[model samples]
Structure formats: C-alpha cells, structure tokens
Target: MSSLPAPTRRSLLGGAGALGVAGALGGAVAAPAHAGPWTPARFKGAKLLAAPDRHLVGRFSYGLTPALAAQVRRRGGARRWFEWQLAPGRIPDPAVGSLRTWWSGLDRGAQELWSRQTSEIEYGWAVMEDYQRYVLLRRTRGQHQVLEVMTEFWENHLHVPVNGDAQFTHRVPYGDLVRRHALGTYEDLLRETITHPAMLVYLNQAVSTKRRPNENLARELLELHTVGRGRFTEDDVKSSARILTGWSVDLWRTWRASYQPEQHWTGPVRVMGFHDANAAADGRELTHRYLRYLARHPATAQRIARKLACKFVRDDPPQSLVDHLAGVYLAHDTAIKPVLRALVAHRAFRASAGLKVKDPGEDAVSTYRALRVAIARPPEGERGEQYAANAILWQTAALGTTPFEWPRADGQPVDSASWSSPSRMIASFELHYTMSGGWWPTAGTGYRRPGQWLPRRRIRFDVLVDHLCQQLLGRRSTATLLKACSEAVGVGRREVITREHDLVRWSMPRLLTTLLDSPYHLRK
Candidate 1:
C-alpha cells in the first residue's frame, strides 16, 4: 500500500454524509416493523427474511447470504437454526478444513517455528500474517459460522496478539486452544489459556519465578480477563502474580512449556474472597482452584456477560439484560452455550438489528461474502495478489487493522463508536467499490459478471435495484435505497435495463457500491 494524502474531515463527511451514513451508521439502521420469524414482507411484495431471522443471522454470523438465509428457513426459522448451530461437530465444514493446508505454517510447532526465524527461513511477523489470513478465510468461507463467530469473541477476550516476540511461536497453538473451548465453560477456557505458552510468554509469565514473580499476566488476568478494573487492590495483584509463578516456558530455545515445581512461589495468597494455602511448590492444583473460583466470581460473571451482550446485542447493553445473562452464566457453571441461548432469547437482542458496527475485519469478510467472491488456492510461494490468501490479509490491512493485531492486552474495542469514524467509513467505501469492480486481487479470485446480477434478460431499473437490495441487504428495496441507486447509476427508476445498457456494462459497480456503503450493510 502506498501512502496517500491525509484525509480531511470535510471531504470524508461530504462523501458519505449525502447518504446519511455519517450519523445513521453510529446507531441502528432504521429497523423495519416488528414481525415474527416466519412472517413474509407483505408490504414489499417479496418474501424477504423476517426481522427476527435477519437480526439473529446478522448478529451471529459474518454476514447473511441467500444460501444462509435459506438454511435458516429450512431449519424452521432462525431460532431452530441457531439451536442446530450450537453443536458444530455435526456440521461439515470442508471449506475451512482445507484452508489449513493452504497455510501449513499454522500447524508448525513452537520449536520449528522459532528455529525458522532464527535461521532466516521465515520471519515471525510473516508467520503471524499467515495466521491472520487463515482466520479471515475461515470467517469468509466457513460453514460453521456460529463457531467462527464465538471463536473470534473468545480469542479477543483472552487475546494474545500474534506479533509478540518469541510468543509468536505458540500463537497458532493458542488460537487452536481457544477454538476447542470456544463454546465450553469459561472456567476451563480461562485456566487453559492463562497457562498456555503463548499467554505466558506474551505477558512475561514465562520468565516469572519464585524469586521474581512477573505481574504482567497476573495483572491482566485480574483486570482485563476476570474481575475487571476497580474490583481488586494492588496487594491482590501481587498475590495473584505469586499464585501464577509455576507455569513457565523454555523461551527462545526449545520453546517447551511445563509446570516447574521449583519455580512456584510458596506463600499464602488471596484474590477477592478466594484464598489459598500455597504450602507446596507444586502449585498446579492451587492454580486450578484459584482460576475456577475467579471464573465463578460474581464480578467475573457480570464482566463476561456484559462483554457477550455488548458484542452480540449492542454496545451499551441494558443492565437488566446483563444481570439476566450473569445469572445464566452462574446457573450453568460458566457454560457458554446456555448463556448464548438466553441472550438470543432476550428481547433486546432480538430487537438490536443493525445496532453494532462491523469492525475492519468484519467489514472486509462480509464484503467478500456479500459479493460472492470465489477464492482458489494460490501457487506455492506466490506473492501479493498472486496469492489470494495473502491478498486478503493485505485487503484487511488496507481497510484498517488485520485480525488479532491489537497491541494492548485488553484486545480490540467492541464499541460502535470506535469503528464509526469518517476515515474508516471512507476506506470501507473504497473497498466495496474495489471488490465490486474486481479491479484488484485478480489472481485466484472469481468475480461475478455484471450480467449475473440481473435476474432476467430485461427488467426495470427500480425492480433491478430491489433485486440487488434482496441480494445484498436481505431485504426489499426501500424508497431511500431506490433513490440512491438511481443517482448512483445515472438512470431513472423506471428505465428498462439490459445487458448492453451502460448501467450494466460499466456502471453496475457504482450501484453495488452504493448499497454496500449504506448503513444496512455497514452495521451489523
């Protein structure tokens, strides 16, 4: 990517403000009237996805597709479809299964991964970049959309960025650990992730010992991961750090992780209400007990529930909803599935259509899905656009940040305002237009022809716009969308469109970009 001139606020606002995106995108898109999951859009004269179905699929999955919508309907509405998705083992995800073969470095062990960098065979950052591409590909093509969605949520919650020094060696394995327990109990997930070599090394726990207990991981485990801020004192942080001393990795050499009894700090420890004797050097059992206690703590439950609600329902979720989810979390012993069930059943979640803004990664992946872009395996060792996987990472970087690249341990912000800036919106607009026109990333990519967008040989422009609205937004065209499309393609609403018409020949991307730039696609 080349450097461009700095974006002025006036130009960005002018470019997107005309369509009411600058303000409307910061909140929910104007929602349609409330309808049952199986209700038809009688007013629009099209069998569009009911409001409930749209809200559920949009919130849980990357983006809605005609195929996905059909699957939701086939499973007897979104509620039933969600129930089936809870057990991902029954779902066959062949597309994402093959992606690992494309990026074999993802399967590399810690020792070899580090050795490759030491010997200049590959750079750590390059390997991490491959991991980013792998995740983006999964989000774009994976059939187990719910699993992918939760995997991202949990990964961000217990974040270990891929660019950490020697910890990058274990980053891939850390991600695998999170996915395995994505829908499992938080007690198990928190215990396992906090002990993983990636987390230890990233937060300096790998070097922590009885003589010197590193407080980085311990502080984050308390502040960001568990009870959150203002819940614990500095002395509690010290005790937490001492309790976490035994888990270590042979960093920068063999890169193997083990629980060394000699490295464990021995003393009394207390965090909040939980207390431990810490009499033995083998502190593994004590660590487990402590983590389980924290996972079941009221503050921790409230924090986890609020984060889930913020990510799935809305940024500032209602206190009542938060309290309800926390109760569910405790009632199920920290199991995530039951809590997710309660969340989707909540009225606020059902009514929160288009309330959340898509971050850069979500924006890119959803656009790829919306455009129905097909990706092929690239030739081995290819570079740039010659490799679709690599190109996709660059595409995300162009939008803003790549996946898991947040520098802080708290992970990326989950609020809509963080991702709703004019500059980000402008970048998204450019990406939509670029992908729509198939102007870049030509290799190993199959872009739909302009004619394929037309359902029939001849159709009125207004009807064509409605068809596109159905395809892109999963709803019928609105008066606002129709007017935008007309102005975008320089055609009257009632004008007849054909394959040879200028609108279809060279200007179709403009119309698609307009829809993509709309809040209907930008949010949720």
Candidate 2:
C-alpha cells in the first residue's frame, strides 16, 4: 500500500459530527412506565405473540422474517436466541453457498491484492451492501435470525475502514477473517488482525517501520482493541509499536508477504514493562512468544469484557458484570462464545431494557428484516448483473453503513450522541418513508399486495400500525402516536381508502421514522 495522509484527532471528531442526525417530533417519548427490564417475561407465553412479526422481531434479530422470529420464539425468547448468535459456528449459514463461492475465487495472494485496491469508502459500501443483502435474504427467504445478528456483532467488534481509495478491497478479507474466528478465541482474532491487510492499512501498521515507528495502530490496539485508555502509557504504545514494526503488506502482490527481517530493527523494545529484543539472533520463536503473551494479558481480557458488556449488556454495565466477564475471558483463554453465553444468561443482559442505541447499520437491517424484504441475486444473465449491482448499491446507501467505509480508524460509534444528529435523523426519516412508501423502483415483488395475491386478504392500516409499533417499540404505540397515525389515514382520499394501500404505504414509514427518532428508540 502507498503512503497515506495521517488522520488527526480533529478529522476523527469532525467525522463523528458529520454523521449525526437531528431531533424528531415526539422524540421525548419514553419507554412504557411498566415495561421493566428486558427479560423472558417480556416475551413469555402470551396469546398476542403471533409468530414474531417481522417488524417487531427485526428490533432484536438481525433481520426480521416470520420464520426467523418463530424460531427465536420457539427457542424460548431473546436471551436464548442471543446465546445462539454469540456461538458463530452454531448459527446455521443459510446463504453459505454464495459466500463460499465468493471466498473460493480468491487465493491468499489475490485476496491481499484485492484488499489493497478497494478504497475505504467503497469497502464501506460493499460491507453495508452485504449486510443489507444478508438481512434481506434471511427475512425474505432463509429465515436465519441468529446468524445475521452474530455476523453483525462480529463485524462491529473488528471494524475496519472501507472508504480510502485502496481500502475497500480489504473489507471482504477483514470481514472473512472476523467471521472465520468470530466464535473462536479472542486471542486468535487479535493475532489474525495483527497481520490482516485491512487492519494494517486502516491503523497505519503497514507503515510502522523500525526507523520511524508509527504509534497510530499501537494506540488503537490498546485503546480500542485491547486495553482501553488509562490502562497503558504512551511509552507502552511506543514500545508496542516497535515490537510490531517490520510488518507490512504487498499491495501489488497476491497473498500477505512474510515479515521482512531486513526491515526489522533487531533492538531492545519495552512494552508494559516487558523488555525484549527484535533481533533474529533471539529467533522468531521468541518474538512470536511475546506476541502471544500480549494476547493473553489480563488487561486485554478486561478490555474485551468491557466492550462485550457495552455491546450486549448495557452502555454502562455494572462493575460486577465486567469483572465476571473478564474472568470468563481469561479462564476460557479469551473464548468469545463463553463470554457471550455468560452475558446472555446474566441478569445484566436480560434486565437492561432500553439501554442500547441502534447504530445506523443495525437500524436499516432491522427495518428491512421486519418488513420481510426479499433480496436475491439476479439471474445468470445481464439483467441478473444489473439487479445485483442495484441491490448492493442502493440498499447500502440508504442504510448508511456501506462496507469498509468507516470515516475514521475507531470505526462507527455505537452510542446515541453520534447517530442522533439532525442530519442523520432527517436521512433516517426520508429513508424509512421511501421504503415504507414502496418508492424504490428496484424493490420489486416484495411489497405486500392484497386480494389478488392472497384472497380474503386486505391490507389493514391499523394492523400495519400495530405491527410496526411492536417491531420498533417492542410494544404498542401510545395514545399520541395512535391518534396521529389515525388522523393521517383519515385525510387520504376515497381511492386510497378502498385499498388502504397508499395510507399504509405512507403512514407506516412515517410512523416508524417518528418512533425511531423517539427517545425510546434510542434505548435498547
């Protein structure tokens, strides 16, 4: 990869501001007073629970489909369902055939070359496209909810940029790396990323040579990846960077090239109080041993635990929960599955109602899933190619999570501050309205049609509203929302009334957007 401009603190902060969306009407709406913490009771044996409506199920599941939600409900609720997702291998791959084909086409060498060519922005677009397609397919065809959610979790955990000119290609390889080891040990995931072309480029590790060591990757490796701020010092970062030097990628070449001993400075380096030499005289075995040592460090365990807790449990999870998870990570050798399992089983995860804010990607995937939008590859001709291109590009852009295109090295933030800006809010509203209105020309056939498609069927405005309420709010709407939607429906003309299609098409998305902008939507 060629040398790139260094990303500054100001640039990163500015990027966050640019992604923020604005406030919405009724944004002050709070969760139901008696809703209580998220628990099995929230989804217990209730007569009203009808095969997990795609809209409602999409909130918790990756994509919503009646079949997928049914599976989750049958498995006994969201807690158990989440457990299955954390165990990546256990989640059945409904679309593995195409994915396998995609992977097989690349050898190690070609894979590296591809990673080097795709810009970060394009990479973001691709990842977002894949994510959207994955949700659409599962909701419309395959009905694999657990798989989708797990894929999402793993992707965010190991996020890489896909927007730079030469960064997009790295998205697939980086994503592949994450999926491959998502259920495996965190140590393994860490080691794989150390050499992964995507991470190297995104974090500037590729430029971290002996003569002028760059601390960009090293700082993030500690702050974001392993031990967060306050856990390590600037000196520690410098030393760590030294240890990571001589590791670079060959953009023009196919597979990842080996560590160049000639490029390495065989000198002493200290990381976290541990001193070691990078000299070949000490042998590659010793250097590798040190890498493994860092992987298993107690601080790494703590950092990983905190991140998981923030993701699955709550934004500010209890200290006790963090301690317990850290212990589990260390005991299990940083096994991701066990930590996730413990989280699902713990009271923290089950009881933390409305604690998390949905990132843009999650919101889009969940919405499409709930609607049961079917996304399929085009047929094996020119038309098929066009369909594929359109599907990949439009959905990603609409959802705001195009692959490999994260604007900064830290990746997209999961909190409310970054996602809830005025502009983003407007974008969300427009996207939701357009999707609900069935405005996208390319989204064919999936839109629900009454009478002709299914006799005795009529699209009921109330039913649609009710369903969307459950999906977006995990409960029915308040009197305020219900009244607003009813008034909106009443204003439509007779032609729209007889079909109830236009009303639903217009109101559903509006209602969803309004709800998403609500304070309740910002919570878990």
TM-scores for all candidates?
0.94, 0.74
How far residue 26's Cα lies from its native spot in candidate 2, in Å, is 10
The candidate that achieves the highest TM-score relative to the unseen native structure: 1
lDDT of 2 by residue, 202-246 (tens): 677776677988888878777777766787888888877777777
Q: What lDDT tens digits, residue by residue, belong to model 1 across residues 147-259?
A: 99999999999999987778899999899899999989999999999999999999999999999999999999999999999999999999999999989999878999999
For candidate 1, the clash count comes to 0
Model 2, backbone clash pairs (residues 3+ apart or across chains), number: 44
Give the per-residue Cα lDDT of candidate 2 at 473: 52
Candidate 1 lDDT for residue 487: 59
Error of 2 at 127 (Å): 9.8
> Whole-model Cα lDDT per candidate?
0.85, 0.54
Q: Which candidate should be chosen as best, given lDDT against the real structure?
A: 1
